[model samples]
Target: MKRTNCKIAFNDKLLMLFAIPLLSFIIPIVFFGCRLNRQPYFNVARFFSTFIIIVLLWMVNRYILIWCRKRYPRFSDVRKRLLIQISTMLLVTLLGNNLLHYILTETIFTENPVSVFDTDHLITSNAAAMFCLIMIIGIYESIYFMHELRSSVQETENLKRENLAAQLNALRTQVNPHFLFNNLNTLISLIPENPDHAVDFVQQLSKVYRHILEVKDEKSIPLKDELDVLHAYTFLMKTRFDKNLEVNVDVPAEKLQKRIVPLSLQILMENAIKHNIVSSDKPLQINVFTDNGSLVVSNNLQMKKQVNESTGIGLNNIRNRYKMLSDAPVKVTESETNFTVSIPLIEQ
Candidate 1:
């Protein structure tokens, strides 16, 4: 079984509770004899005396820690807990040693035994050394706990951010279906008069929708992939407008190999079409070109007077998605005659 499974058996409390006292008693008894003059049976008596002291000390330590935890439930501040633990350990050790010494010296150790209290100087010096050892252990435990707590908090925050991003992406994906539906309705209206054009239009429409579905699982797609979708979309528009729709693409093939947020170009194209008019007399001349490491999509502004349902969500969604990846802002240039959108190209 795993070490974590063993820890769980004790409800996550430290397993040192059993081992510490046993080791503490064994070490002192083996090293230090009961009688300083080295009499017979000194080792045996010392072993039993040390064992009793170890058991009592362990009980006192556990009780004190449990009491402190219960009293101050929100006492999670590492520094504060360290101070309390250090203070309690010193107090307990001093009291325990003195109580053990008094009991053994007065009752059990009436014959040849170890000295309970040496003198004024020795008692003070021994107490200081014991206090220092306890404080060091407490500080180490506090630092360890503090580091673990910080890591746990950071992991929780990262998970939350990921969940929020996934929800936002799902909402953005929904916009593509609405755009496809509108374009399909327009193609249906023109199918009777121009059957051949409509057939070509349906083929281009299929390519565009297929691209969207293929890239849906991707957070970002190569610039080349996005341009392929854009080309398909423009082909459908050409089928609808014939020679009247003038579309130009001047992006570098090298730069097109880089990555960009999926459907970014398509959304901008849809926005341009939705807000402007396309006709023979004043034909929609839309341009896609790169300038200064950025892709620029610009078109002549011929605004439609008729207002449509404005969710005001598409541009904001695109902006938000880009923000998650980089610091570069989506630049929008608007005038009486033209509307241009400049999007930064991201390295894969």
Candidate 2:
């Protein structure tokens, strides 16, 4: 951190190489021109002394400004940090002005031994210098703010990309070769014994895939659409397991109109099935309902002796997408008898 402070302010190298040194030379020439003399004349000694003081003063304020920026980088912290910065700059400016006055008094009076007392002229020049530097500080702050805003936006975009990738991976798992092989095996058995049921199974499987493709590009969709797709997906699942799997969706019609991340319910259902045992003796039960402004998904605890391979992104992907979309949270909890997920249903 100490080494960081020694670097050029805000990583803008031109500030040190150009702006500060150039201003140091120009400020005194423009403000204190010939005030010590009754007539206009160049005072090399006075110019050099004032330039050094201005350079030191500007550097100190610049350091303080950068330090304050680092300590309070967020936009919410802007007011508190700006107050600290401005107050510190005020103190530095006053002390610098006194040093400048003393240097000018020594160098100019020595150069011209018969000059009259011109304290008022010198004091007025110092006041103007202070105000001008404050304006310069304001300009630097604007640049810092713009840079911070850009960085924040970039971070959000990166998170969105990650969320989409996770969603794609979950979809891929649904349509992967192993899942296709098992369902096709079931279809082959059903076709000979129950042709009509086999046809319905094929249609439901197609609906599941169609819904996945349709919602791939969407950030979120109505819970109504999600449940429509969930029913299609569950049809395929129940055909595979028969009485071994039971899913109860009890959400109110009004709750279905709310929005959720695309395919969120499907992902949660997949997670529950992968981790739990589904058998004739101890059938798996999954419940979907609305509770306290959230969409609740829960399942009974019936752990499998050997769990299937998982991508581990289902819940995390929903959470990340919701963070980008709303202030609401996705909550997960596990107890002695059940595992539950409560996802906020967004209103806006």
Candidate 3:
């Protein structure tokens, strides 16, 4: 990266040297109708001497600014870095003007020393040169900043898309046959003892799967739609834990129209159960409520001593999905006795 930046800086210097001098010569000949067309040698020598000095000043200013930016990056330390930049530019402009004035008076236009060194002539020439040179540097920096901004925006968008795809893949894994197999075994056990409840279980299971499939293309869904999906998921969990797992949702009717990342509640609930001991002796109680335009999911912590290994994909998926869907974060609060997550309820 350092080597590439050095190469770019070298190319920019070359481009400025060639382009600025060529334009300087052409503008007078084409637009101003200066007799530079008749006295090509004098005109060429004058412009060439002046541009050579300006280019040197530009190269020095560029190097100094690059060093300042590296030491105090604009994004991290904007005020200090900009102060250093302006000071450096002024110093370079002063030195460059003095150098140009000396060259014109001593060598290039020696026949007119009085005009070159006269107070008014010196002030006008120095001011014009400083303004033009600084403008060149300013334009270059502006273009570079614009390019960087565009690249940063594009990279952020790409990362958002990639994370969204990862969330989808994780959701797909959750809905795959391995997950179905466990529930299938539970259903098999229930069918022989309670045939009617097994039918209801199968129906809810189908609804849960359908909801997952339907939300694949959606970034956010109404809270009520998510609640319906959560109800279907709760039915499946109830089959396994029965009285050991209790879930209560207490959201008001007015908040139902608010939006959230789909399946976020289900993911949080599952995360709570996966890490907790759910048994008749120590039941896991999960509560879903709304507070200050936020959906809060809290569960009593009864951490299991032994359980199946956890992959932690669900919570991460929910967090990543929330990041893409809204600027508000999925806030988590944990303690020795409870784990809570608050998701910002987006207005539809």
Give the winner by lDDT.
Answer: 2
User: Where does the lowest 10-residue lDDT sum fall in candidate 1?
Assistant: 4-13
Among these predictions, the greatest TM-score belongs to 2
Give the lDDT of residue 212 in candidate 2.
85
TM-score winner, 1 or 3: 3
Query: For model 2, how does the per-residue alpha-carbon lDDT over 1-348 read when each residue is reduced to its tens digit?
Result: 323232123555555567665665665556656544555454566566556666777778878887887787666688998899899898878877676666666666466432234676657656756765776677777776676677769969987787779768867877799889988998998999999999999998899888888888888899999999999889989999999999999998888779998889998998888899999999999999999999999999989888767776678788888887777789999999999999999874
Error of 1 at 144 (Å): 23
Q: State in Å the error of residue 129, model 2.
A: 13
Over 33-148, each residue of candidate 3 has an lDDT whose tens digit, in order, gives 44633643336555665566666776777777678767875355767877887788887778776876687668766653545447765665566656666676677667667766
For each candidate in turn, the TM-score is 0.48, 0.63, 0.61
Of the candidates numbered 2 and 3, which has the greater TM-score value? 2
RMSD of 1: 14.0
lDDT, candidate 2, equals 0.79
Off by over 4 Å in 1: 1-198, 311-313
Model 1 misses residue 80 by how many Å?
A: 33
Over 4 Å off in model 2, which ranges? 1-144
lDDT of 1 by residue, 1-348 (tens): 335322112232354555544544544434433344554344555556555665576557655665555455442454576578669877877777677866865688556444555575236434533643464355434554565567657855664465355444534644456766766776887789878878877888788768766776665789998898889988877766767677899988789787787777877776777677877787888899998878899999998888566534456666666665556788889999999988888888
